[model samples]
Target: MDKALPRTIACVTAVLGLALALAGPAAATPGVPAPEASADGTLVSRTGTAVTVTAAVGLSNTISVWQAGDTIRVRDTGDTVTALGGCRPVSANEAVCPGAGSLTELVVHAGDQADDVTSFLESLGVTLVGGAGDDSLYGGGANDTLEGDEGADFLSGGGGNDTLTGSSGRDRLFGGPGNDSIEGRGGGDLINAGAGNDVVSGGNGNDQVIAGTGNDFVDGGPGQDTLDAVDEVGGNDYVRGGDESDTCRADLGDSVTECP
Candidate 1:
């Protein structure tokens, strides 16, 4: 895309040094397409033989690695060099185009399994946003936002004020710290308010919640549900209802507990 990405991404790439060298050149396979960058991000043709992303140019860029047949495309606004073959590893100190372009570094990946996405962000200590898939360890950083679209998913609010939402299917949410909100649209769900003021709501099926500390609010929107609050200066904790009977627990220190 022509629009510039946040400078923080570039800083992250530089600090983490997650850049790799472009793959070596090879004869074009008949149905294979070359990796190309687009406004949305990098689009790799499914038929591509290999895809390599040089850290120097693609650090600040969010490259969407996709496949089309045997081709792979890398679309972005940042500067890039292509080899039209397969990707390979390069040393951090390796020099290339000293004057024309600067170098960017990235941490090494330890696992042998295919871990392009996870290894990339883990190198930078930046959390990867979950797409339309089953995600377990989701959410990180201050005010992190986790969205699960389709399929069963799991979201965790690592720290600070966070928001977690599940669009469909069975979901699990954990509010780790600060004020947080967890919303589940469909299917049975489990929610945990780890700390701070938190709010949790379930859409359908059976649901369970463990509200940890501070003033908390929990709502079991449908089916049978259960709620818990251990011990605290528990004051007016709101528990909204939908259909069907629900069970609620009051801690020894509850000042004002409301359930319906």
Candidate 2:
């Protein structure tokens, strides 16, 4: 019995040693490396240390490979770029962007050309300023201010209390919600006050103004114009036709008085 026990113990010890030897190399070896992640947009060109990213039209993208002292160029191809992060405009065509991971404030500036611009908002606020050329701007959620400085423009305030100004040329303006203020500074313009109580003025040219929903104050400034404020059910609106011979339609309990 003693001889049989010695044989059994030796056989068990030999098996354990073989198993440990077989498992040692695998336990000591390093794991396989993870696949590298690619940047968001198409890498159009890489010259020396500078990289140019051509984001798909109407789509916004971020490149993570940008390091300090690296020049990053973005090409939007006539589409408006809404920055979800920090971006400062160096020129009408270029900008200094924030880091890829920091998706913070939305900083947006219009491009050089006169083109249509669209913006959407989440919980964060947005600011959109137009360029020298004719631009069409849409403000989607936040309390936004849409300013059309130079040429003929179209500005729409989607939600929030917004300020829309058409500085020059023939323009179109629409106010979506909350309390809004709209001004068409020059050329013949069309203005619509969508939901809340609003103050609207057609600055120059032969303009048309429509006050939709809430109590509104509308002024047709200068040229021959048309004003309509009959849309609100329980709203009291004031329509003043300024300067030239103007035609105005008012809601029940509303007032229409010609300017001196």
Candidate 3:
């Protein structure tokens, strides 16, 4: 454990305050922070070195998690929904949000336990950051992001074109149904860029990368990794196996860089 870390992790993240629903596993290390769950709902906050984010669930039950500068905040309420993309919710479930969505960043601190997060509504880019456990994080709407801080984690970009980062451990990363980007920062990893044109990197481990169905860029970085261009359509993709001895598969009209 890094003593420099704030020493807190997220247990689970609610979907706009759905904390009562996705309660998964315990922290790999104790003393991590997670929102409390009760009939009345709960409010929780975690602070890191440079950022602080809060999570909440209220009686009215709508979650709001966003970042302001370096300070990120989350609040869930049954009585009121937070103004997202400059549109205030007149009702809990109903809001005439504009087509051009506006939320840029959201922050969540998951514990070292296995956890999950979800959001549905407008294309507000949400960011979910996981802790030390084998966590699972999901991104929603337009241009979202998910980061698995430690442990064997799973990250999926749900709808919009998004970015997924597997920070450590043997993690699984999936890009969305849109043009996406993914990174396997360390440890052995499995990466799949699901749809549209994508960019991927398998960093510092023996990884299995499947560039799915698009003109994509794949980099098997610093390990004996396998890079596969699983291009089903008539698409050309690029693959590069970095550092160690690697295996690469590509189709015609595709570019290969230092990969065999």
Q: Which candidate is the best by TM-score?
A: 3
Ranking by lDDT: 2, 3, 1
Q: What is the TM-score of each candidate against the true structure?
A: 0.51, 0.61, 0.63
- Candidate 1 residue-wise lDDT at 168: 63
**What Cα-based lDDT does every candidate model obtain?**
0.47, 0.60, 0.60
For every candidate in turn, the CA RMSD to the true structure comes to 17.5, 29.1, 15.1
Q: Which is the winner by TM-score between candidate 1 and candidate 2?
A: 2
Clash totals, every prediction: 33, 0, 13
TM-score of 2: 0.61
Clashing pairs in 2: none
Runs in model 3 with CA error above 4 Å?
1-104, 232-235
Report the lDDT tens digits of candidate 1 across residue range 1-260.
22333443343333222111100110111111212333322222111322234323123332232223333233323323332223321222111111111112211111111112322121112222334446443443445445555557677767766666765678888878777767776888888878876667777878888878766656677778777765444333444555777777754334222355
Per-residue CA lDDT of candidate 2, range 1-260, in tens?
56555654553444334334432432332222212212332223333322223333223222221223423333343432323233444443344554422323333345334655565543334445555577777886767667777688888988987778787688889988867778887899989989887778788899999988776777799999999888745226667899999988875445567943
* Off by more than 4 A, model 2: 1-107, 232-235
lDDT against true structure, model 3: 0.60
Give the alpha carbon lDDT tens digit for every residue of 157-255 in model 3: 877877687866999998869877778888999998887767787889899999887567778999899999967532256577888799998764355
Candidate structures ordered by TM-score, highest first: 3, 2, 1
